[model samples]
Target: MAKNASKGASRIRVGVGGWTYEPWRNNFYPAGWPHARELEYAAGKLTAIEINGTYYSTQKPASFAKWRDDTPDDFVFSMKASRYSTNRRELATAGESIERFIGSGISELGKKLGPIVWQFMPTKRFEPEDFEAFLALLPHRVDGLALRHVVDVRHPSFKVPEFIALLRQYKTGVVYADTDEYPSFADITSDLVYARLMRSQADVDTGYGASSLDRWAQAAKTWAAGGEPADAPRVTSTPAPDTPRDVFIYFISGAKERAPAAALALLQRLL
Candidate 1:
């Protein structure tokens, strides 16, 4: 739900979380640009953008269609499911709410719909049975198009093997959180990989230091080639899947002023 976005190979998608930032006007976007053209302009720059707006409210079908059309042919958008589904007292009681979120004209995005990020609160403890039931509620498809689901658990207790095993059982990937405030687990469970980097420095042109980007670039290559960085955090002690992973990395809106530049800088290295 926070702002960010990139690295590695053809399966990689690099970009920010949202595009309608007022600070981005003179910083990332060109000065005096039209307000309505923000999505159109930002879409062209990043290969993908996480639909953070959807996390707050349900968007109309027309709006979804417009967003799909505004981006380039290969552009992908990962949406965050509504908090109403996850913030409830019990995770098992979210079936109808999750269904409502999926039925909210998300199909209008068609193939442009990438993955759905289900982020949990930092206080949301990892309950094996309840969490597994919640995962079961995730539909594999909506309107005949298959979906990819990624979970972002912020609780420090999620750094357990059982949680990772449960995610692997559901074929769900875990978000590789690169922030001190969240639990940063880098375990790979699905064909896709999701990462949100938040340690951007406003003074740095690329948001990240040169060495950090280099390490990320290398780690991305490892991920794309079906491997992992030796230094990355992990909950599962077992090995990663043998197949290649589609990587999605982002330099999120931490040091907000330089996010886009960081994404572009990382994407440039990959390209």
Candidate 2:
């Protein structure tokens, strides 16, 4: 069962990228489990889910409402913003695409909505002015609901301190991608902490080893409590203010089949 932190502590939510995976049927899901009820079952085990389909195509408002209703009241979903807004040569020209994606009825998720992740391609270099323009295009509210935005910048160009400063200026969070394949950095620029743990091993029963899960649990708690992990790699040495911040950690993109086990293991540790 999921456990809540002490009263007044910031929440640390652990989950996987998406709920529908064929491999999960043999392991994570019960035998003969129906496909339509996968989200309901997954939500009962994990605290959050990173909705990836929206990145590929727009979803109907009914779909969002269905997702919201299927999950537990406290469950949250972090959606990946459409690629049309991020995968481009000129970031400044993505305003219309951004508006369209937001206006596509994402607010139907209502209180269940978490952060909207704007992910860029690995080749997309960080151009400060253009990147700032793109960030400025992100609206703070849509349909009377507040929105939180985070960027997943994969290019090595984003490793510079200037990139962290830009994120801070816009109050946008930077996704701390925990992987050797991408540019990973831990810098607190917003009120929330987002991390995508992408190094799950298929050979391990829990994706990551028990010791690794323990360490990650500690890191997640530290982040939620408003202190940076001493072992976290960072782009800047400057410290973030000591204030409680909500934390979201998703087991993503490694051995996809083991993501649910990894998330469940992490949630057990958090509890």
User: Which candidate's TM-score is highest?
Assistant: 2
Question: Each model's TM-score, in the order given?
Answer: 0.95, 0.98
lDDT of 1 at 212: 89
For model 2, give the 10-residue run with minimal summed lDDT. Answer: 1-10
Model 1: lDDT of residue 191: 87
Per-residue alpha-carbon lDDT of model 2 for 135-187, expressed as tens digits?
A: 99999999999999999999998999999998999999999999999989799
lDDT of each: 0.86, 0.92
Error of 1 at 254 (Å): 1.3
lDDT of 1 by residue, 1-271 (tens): 1112222333777888888888799778899989899999888888888989888898999999999999888788998999899987799999999999999999999999998999888899988999999999999999999999999898888889999999889999899989998889889888888999999998898899888888887887778878988999887779886677788887786897788898888877775
